[model samples]
Target: MSTAQALSPSSRAESLKKLEETELDVLVIGGGVVGAGSALDAATRGLKVGLVEARDFASGTSSRSSKLFHGGLRYLEQFNFALVFEALRERSLVLNSLCPHLAKPVPFIYPLEKLIDRPYVGLGIGVYDVMGAGRGVPSHHKHVGKKKTLESFPSGKRSAIRGSVKFYEGQVDDARHTMMLARTAAEYGALCVNSTRVIGFLREEGRVVGVKAVDLETGRAFEIRARQVINAAGVWTDEIQEMVGGRGQFQVRASKGVHLVVPRNRINSSTGIITRTEKSLLFVIPWGSHWIIGTTDTDWNLDLAHPAA
Candidate 1:
């Protein structure tokens, strides 16, 4: 496994020494995407920064994202155009500038079950395309006849799809993308340390200052002092907040997502596919020589560290 740019033993020791010796501008907890991004932003502004992670980078929910950076067209029912547009903008940036090699286009087929539904569905999709305006990624949706749809996705039942609309969306390697963020943050001078758990917070008076952490590998304890401390702990945010003697404004409920990986040969498709379900959307994404099919979302009440399938 990749250590996500962790330092050597001596280097880690030196980093620990520096953390004690100097007061940093920012101390970020968690090694997920948000934490990595925060570290990068702080370091880029020439701020002294330190980031600590409880486990390997992207070991948490960051690695389990749907792997697609997309504007939710389905949100149109709720008139969430602003959110859709904003998402599309970010998707374009990721595909065009941030991490082009890791994010690419995946075609989706939205099957239409009735002839009468054609014009309405097409118009909505058109609006969805327009919202993603100016994005270098393809924003056009194609109208495909029933036969053509089957030719593209032979596995789909013909009765369910009277016709189909094909459109392009962004896909990425979630784990790798998140890891790259941490790597880039480190490159920009953020001290990225993984396998270091925050045991408690260092509070002075009514405000927070830093954290008391344990190096999991060496079983050594250390303190990191900073002007600002950020908790990008994802689902564990509530726990961290409670540790500081205050319940955050919001509570975080953990959701377990499940995905299945299968060989490419098993799924006959010219492009990736997303179909509607009673409770949610099912996406079959094309990964390097395989297809990732699933994403069953439900409440999780088990172990936070290791959620069983």
Candidate 2:
């Protein structure tokens, strides 16, 4: 078992306090992708940074993502051009420049059922492919007839798919990637201590300055001073903001998305698939050993400490 899995929350907290008092330029709270990225950004920018996480890294929504680092294809339907384009750029950068070893390309097959659907879906997918072409990802997706589509995916009925468009996107092991990011930030001189809970904010002159945290393992408490504090606490962002008396500019709405994992061999497919959901999109992503499926987007009002499956 990893040390992360074995460490008591109290013990983790004590270590963090000892590390935090050792001097730092920036203190980042949370250890999800955004927080970890922030720490890395601060450290790389020549700031002495410290990062504390209340749980093992990526133990939140970051690890529970769809795992695709892609330009949102469905977002095009809503005319979310800016988001799509920006994501395409970031996807390429991550796959090629940032973390090639962790991010790799995967093909997805979009099945078209009707003749008219082909032109419409093809056009949108064509634009998507073109927008991302010449990036680190593949150039263009190919259109395959029903015969080829069925040949490619043995599990689907021959009559089920009129044709299929195969496109590519990037994938990553979210947990591993997140951990590596934290590790890399630490390597660059960021003090990263997991299992340290930020109990409250240190304030002065009606402004936030630092944080008072507890070592969940040893039950010890300490204070770390910083010029600015970033709350990348995701689902708990509001709670963290409340700790500092709730004076933030933005409010977060909670949504729940659930994914199911099944053996890859159970679903015979040459590539992954995407289908339109009533509220959003559903994907059958091909993980190395399993096929990750199901994502239901709905309002969430439950215990965030344990996300409902």
Candidate 3:
């Protein structure tokens, strides 16, 4: 096991020196969740790993997420059982063993608007609960009558909401969760540095060998050599691929997701509420002192770094 390493200024300086002087077994691009997790995985296996990020950790889509570890109930409507099952299993692992301190079970109420909606929604939730059985969370869902629903969510429209089904999903602070992933990876001997941007790829004989990078903090350019490089840049994958002079095997498209945060009192609900929207599902999640409601999904082809709402 590797000893814990604090990601302090001194440690960062040391890591920067090491990154410049040493040859790495694996180098990871991006500081998002996937990239940080990849570094952690590689370092835990005793590889000399280095992770570089162009900005602060989790400053991208990793931070701008719904912050829910949910088994996509909407996917159930599409009959995607396998995906939901896998997601719930992962959710259980995260809540039960991975980062219980950073994650927990949050109950959500799927409000029914019509009488016929009960049986259908309940059946789907029942299957969801069953599929998620023994996966660390409460595996049963409860159907609440109209009176109970009103009692739980007084702000809910009495005339519109018929009843609701309550189920548990995992909640986490996505930014903190991602930052910890990077810190843990550093603890496991991964040389993680942010504010370092990869500008070009170092290639020989048509094979990638390393990267040409610049430290955005100091405006110093350097090269990092690695036996293997993994790109986990999320939406910026295509741009990274471009540095190598070709389109990658696959392309990445960015989807803009917009979420709104309002005071908790704005929605008088004891638990979260999930409802169907015309284009997609809507979530009114309970935050510490506020409720997070969103998101609108649409294709985005503008600036990747800064997207206007």
Output the number of the lDDT-best candidate: 3
**Tens digit per residue, CA lDDT, model 1, 1-309:** 332454566656666677777888999999998898898889889999998899988999888778888887667656898888888899889989878888987888877788887897788778888888747576588889999999998877878878888888898888888788887777777887888999898988877888899999889898889999999999999989988888987799998888899999997888888776897777888888989888898999989988778
Which ranges of candidate 2 are over 4 A from the true structure? 1-19
lDDT score of residue 209 within candidate 3: 89
Q: Which stretches of candidate 1 lie above 4 Å from their native place?
A: 1-11
Best by the TM-score measure: 3
For the record, the alpha-carbon RMSD of candidate 3 to the native fold, in angstroms, is 1.4
Clashing pairs in 1: none
* Local error of candidate 2 at residue 207 (angstroms): 2.2
Candidate 1 to native Cα RMSD, angstroms: 2.8
Off by over 4 Å in 3: 1-4
Predicted candidate 2 versus true structure: per-residue lDDT over 1-309, tens digit per residue? 122222344544544654666656788899999999998889889998888899878999889999999899878888998899999999899999989988999988888878678888888889988788748867578888988888888888676679888889999989888888887787676778886899998888987778898877677888988887889898888899899885577777888888899999999998999877677778999988899997887788998867787
Q: Roughly what TM-score does model 1 have, to 2 decimal places?
A: 0.93
The total number of steric clashes, by the backbone 3 Å criterion, in model 2 comes to: 9
Query: 61-152, model 3: which lDDT tens digit per residue?
Result: 99988999988888887899999999999999999999998998998999999989999989989999998884767657999999999999
Q: Give the Å error, residue 194, model 3.
A: 0.5
Clashes of each: 0, 9, 0
Q: What is the number of residue pairs that collide in model 1?
A: 0
